[model samples]
Every structure is written in structure tokens, then in C-alpha cells.
Target: MKSGFPSTSPFRLPPWAIRLARRQQNSMAGAADRMRFVIQLALTNVTAQTGGPFGAAVFETKTGRLIAIGVNVVEPTNCSLAHAEVVALANAHANLKQFDLSAPGMPKLTLVTSCEPCAMCYGAILWSGVRNVVCAARGSDAAAIGFDEAPKPKNWVATLEDRGISVTRDLCRDEAIAAFQRYQQTDGRIYNARKGLT
Candidate 1:
């Protein structure tokens, strides 16, 4: 007698898709372009799943390597802390197998998020050691779409930059807002525990 079971395999993209991704990565000339591309990728991923309209990606700036793409999975995963930035950072760390993101000489990595990170994600970025952050939308943009973003101090950017993590805001702002608008139009579930309060 023998037991039968399906074998598990690692996820792999088609060769053509990989080539296309590489080309796109190479073509990103500035922070806006890269942030737009990643946010679009994130939107595509999240739209396929049941989650809020937020996405994130991690990229190695020096080599133009697309490290990881993440979509907000909080609603699908039933976890409040599963923000897109957090999920993306976790994926990047796991893929690289290096948790000390701040180590000297580590390749410069940028975290691009569709919206400004909430308080939880902000902390995650600091600890994850990404050297730079690019955001397409501000927290108020998400709040306008009915998502409860945490209250951040007015000097948040300065705070992050002071720690060696440069912050760029409003990259591809219009496109990011459009993504949230589409989600709202589709009646996507807006999971805000403190909906009315914050």
C-alpha cells in the first residue's frame, strides 16, 4: 500500500512575464513612475481578492529588482495589522532571508505604498529597514474614501527622514486616488474598527 498526495511547488512566473516585468522595472525612471507601477500591480492583485483597495511593493533601487508586491489582506486574513506595507515588508524579508534590513552596505530598498502608511505600518517600515518610502496618497486620501487611517504627527516625514529613511509623498497621487475611488464605487468593504471615531 502507498499513500498518494500532491506535491507542493514554489510559485514561478512564466518566462515571458518575468521578461516583461524586468523591462518595466528597468524603464522606471523616477520615483513617480515606479510608485505608479507598483500601485497598479497591487491594485490588480487586491482586486482579484476580497480586500480593501490598497497595495504595496518593495524594490531594490540600485539593481532595479522588483523584490515583492503586496496587496492589503487585512479583510481577507481577518487581521487588523495586515496592512499592505507590513505584508510587503514581511514578504521581502522572507525572500531575502535577512531580517537586519539596516545592516551597512545593504542594497538600497524602497517601499512604495498606494497610500500613506497607518501608524502600524509606519513602525513596521522603520523596523523593516527600508531606506526610502514613496507614497501615492496621503492618509487623508484614504480617510476620504472611508478608511480609518491612524492619526500621525504632523512631522511624520521629518521623523522618518531623521532615522535615515527618506520619505516621498504624493507620488502618482491622482492614480492612487482613482484606485480608492474605484473600490468605493464597487462597494468594497471598508474595514474601519473605529469608523465614526477616527
Candidate 2:
């Protein structure tokens, strides 16, 4: 019998495969349950050293099962693309072993973010194969909290819907806003790239 490639080889299994193999599957009740779970997880990032007051998660739409979670990592590290939604999507892809998230035969998935995705994260969602999105606040809300949000085109939600992605805004608007407020109150750094300009 021929032996497989050695484990010490440079070409090792992907991180997602290892994570999936080691972790237990997470199952939830439904949309409401999953939303609550994601909110709680996202809130924990409110005090993170790098990214504060932003959180996101991925869920299986049909099963209502939690897949992966992520928090913003923009400041303190200067990673412009480390939005909560982007991190969550990356985690989902890693855990599910599906880099091309929308590939055929994949389970239906949803991206739940504490705030509406900015322009970059919006693009990530469109290409991430998640057919549904649940958001706590809109881009304006994040801007209101002192974070610089990129401009979005008119009828953006409609555009996503037209592309077969359903978006549900304001899952818990007040609650989500409260997180940003808390961060602001605690003197959290607001890394606005467009500071000092109109």
C-alpha cells in the first residue's frame, strides 16, 4: 500500500479543515436566536485593543446554526480591510473549507453584523456566497459614532436583493448603537481615515 504525503510536508491541510475537525458543530433555533447569539458575541469586541465596538458572525440559514464569528481589527494595526463583516466572512470560509463561498452545493449562509457593512465589507458580502444578511445599524449609525463610513450608492439594499442576497436591517438598532456609545464614552479611539476633511 502506498502511503499518503507526510504530515511534515510544507503542503499541509488548510486551517479550516483543521478547525472543523476539532470543533463541535454549533446549532441554534432560528433567525431570532441566531441574531441574539451573534449580537452577544460581537459586543465582546467592544474593548478589543485593535478593533473596538464592532462584531460580526456567520450562520447557516436553513439550520440556524452558528458558523463563525469576527470582530473589527482596523486601528492599532492599521488594517483597512479588517471590518467585522470581512473577518466574519473569512472565518466562515475557513471553517467551512469553502474559499469560494457561493460555490455550488454549499449550505445556505447568512452574514450578521453589528453594523451595516462599509463599502469594502459590502463587496466582500456580495462575493462571499452568503444569501442573507442581518444588520443592527446602518452605515450612517457608524458614522454617527465617529467612524468614517464609505459612501454607498442609492438603493444599495435593492442592488443586493437584485443579486439574490436578502438584507434585513435593524435587528436591534438601539442595542447596537448603545455599543458604539459605550465605546465612545470610554474614550475609544475612532480611526476615521477621512478625518480633517469635508
lDDT for each residue of candidate 1 in 1-198, tens digit (9 for 90 to 100): 000000110222223323334455353546776787767755664466446678777777665567765667776567787777877777677666668666676778888899999988988987999999999888999999788787777888999999999998898888988888888877888888886674
So what's the TM-score on candidate 1? 0.82
Give the residue spans of candidate 1 off by over 4 A.
Answer: 1-29, 195-198
Report the backbone clash tally of model 1: 0
The 10 consecutive residues of candidate 2 with the worst lDDT sum are: 1-10
Output the worst ten-in-a-row residue range by lDDT, candidate 1. Answer: 1-10
Q: What lDDT is reached at residue 148 by model 2?
A: 78
Q: lDDT scores for all predictions?
A: 0.72, 0.70
**Whole-structure CA lDDT of model 2:** 0.70
